[model samples]
Target: MGKKSRKNVFTPEQLLSSLMDNIPDHIYFKDAQSRFIRTNRAQARFLGLAKPEDAIGKTDHDFFAHADEALADEQNILRSGKPLVGKIERVRYGKGPIVSVSTTKAPITDSTGKAIGIVGITRDINDRMLEEERLKSAQEELENTVRTIDMELNIARNIQESMLPERLDQIDEVKVAALYIPCSTIGGDLYDVIQIDEDRIALLILDVMGHGIPAALIAAMAKVSFTKHIARGLKPRTVLREVNDELIAHLKNERFLTVFLGIVDKARKEFVFARASHPPALLLRKRRRTVVRLSGKGIFIGFAPRYKYEEERVPLESGDIILLYTDGLVECRNKGGVFYGLKRLERLLLKHRDAPVDELVKRIREAHVEFMGDVPPSDDIAVLIATLE
Candidate 1:
């Protein structure tokens, strides 16, 4: 057999040199006097030296613009024989621009436990610092945007409240009471009591589909429609038809509203009302001690142009109470996901039938709040009660 080839084994110095050459961090050794004793390939490259030996015997002052600070830190490490870990600093390499770095420096000891030199490893952190600054800027921008939106919403709420009537007091023809609560800063609910000539008064309540700014804008349009028709002395059915047509003309999207319009003719002692996919109005009769639900056949407004609406007429008597409301009053949900249905509302009204109109409204509101418990309302609520004197 041919002579066996001798195995090649790397010496410890060769192994150590290879490890320093392969690592990406700048590695160097400094004597107790702060003069460079040795350097790795990465450190030599940073110092613009052709090889590691080229950095031998050089101090930081030979290459760094701010060497005094680094020299003082190295002196402290020598005196205490302690390590400085992950110290962030800025330094210029050769003629390059200043860059951020995280550096760790440890003291080296001899056989007698006396400190001989220091070993330092520095990792570049320029990209990490830039990313942190960008995130901070984005967070500040988001906060400013949220504050501006909140201020604008407050202004919108004030304007919407100003458009609604504060109190529906007892008038010459009929006594009226009402309550309105919006789920947010603004609502999509609107109501009005307009005098249609001397003998007739128009009672109107409308609910747009959604909440917030878009729905509030639609409610504003409904207000304009109601005011225009009532001033023209239009009948309930005719007013709904006209408003439906106007809304269809104004909207280009799928937005719609449910409306209940009633004309109270004091001279004839009659209540003529029309509904457009809205919840039925309730009439409480004191003489019979019963309730009558006023409902009619019609589609939602702004859905189909020229939609025909049917009008319902009910004869009025002394001590008669008419309640008109949005679906929110009846559709309120509790914590158990149960709705405060119309049946509960009817029972409450009958229980407080003899109470004054204002007192009756307050009692109903209280009952609703109690039924809801800790749950919040999911929609806007509005109600109007008219007592025929």
Candidate 2:
């Protein structure tokens, strides 16, 4: 037979003492009067005492800086015979600094289940609380920075919109209408109908390489330069050359613009325009009931400081319509990723050839919206329409 087995057992007092001494968290028991009846070594140390016995018979008010709230909570637990679990609080013991702790307290009951005392456990949560506070502060700072940026962008957008022509006057026999839409708060597309003299008006549209703050700044610079050059009575090709030179001088090679500058010579009944890597201008002839593209060859502005732009002349007849637009119009994609190409634009123009120039502008904008559906244009769009009546 095997040797008789021996069972290792501990008394109730020995088990309680072992658990109270070994656990790192503070543990304590209190009478209904909220006076401490017993405390663990951890609780005594937390209260700046040398041993657990030193905490016996003392109340939290005797050692804690803010103990009124704690005493009230303990009384509530005693009266209700309920437990308060995982309550996070900031507390100070003796003369120590305030620390965050998570505390749990439950009513102690006798054999008949009558409340007789309270038992509690507390764990330090200072580090976790500090980290959470730091994260909340950072989140507030980020939100404030975002609000500041959005406000500035809105102001910039207003300034940019103010730089565009508020009204396109019917200079002599040329009637002009324009529409502009930006994909963001600010855009890089610019257009203007500036009167050079009594018989001539310069119609210009340009698209910077990208959109947003950087592109918007370049667009503003281009608008100012273009207006200044046109004010000097420069022709279409000369305006393009001067604007190109101005941009190349001040800007790095990373930024460039596609420009279409045209001068409507009402006296000669002709439209002479220059292109800088821009889409061709479309002419809708009411007499022929057809649309044609006035093509020209030129490089984008800012490509070369001294590059010369070529110009083309199209004699205008009564009721002829001319459409100048940025690539955003042709490059706009639908949900299916199909481009609203130049062919479709030309067809739309033909369909609305007999409408007034302003009415025709409205029609084109409507068509674009219908084609896009819920899909937004990926770039800024600018359209300028002119009619000879």
Residue 76, model 2: lDDT of 94
TM-score attained by model 2: 0.84
Residue-wise C-alpha lDDT for candidate 2, range 125-165, written one tens digit per residue: 99999999999999999999999878877866776687688
Clashing pairs in 2: none
- Candidate 2: what lDDT? 0.88
lDDT of 1 by residue, 251-353 (tens): 6556889999998777898899999999999999978889999988899998999988999999999888899999999998899989999989889888888
Q: How accurate locally, in lDDT, is each candidate?
A: 0.86, 0.88
Positional deviation of 217 in candidate 1, in angstroms? 2.6
In model 1, where do residues sit more than 4 Å from their true spots?
Answer: 1-27, 33-35, 38-85, 89-100, 106-117
Question: What are the C-alpha RMSDs, in order, of all predicted structures?
Answer: 4.7, 3.8
Evaluate model 1: give its TM-score: 0.81
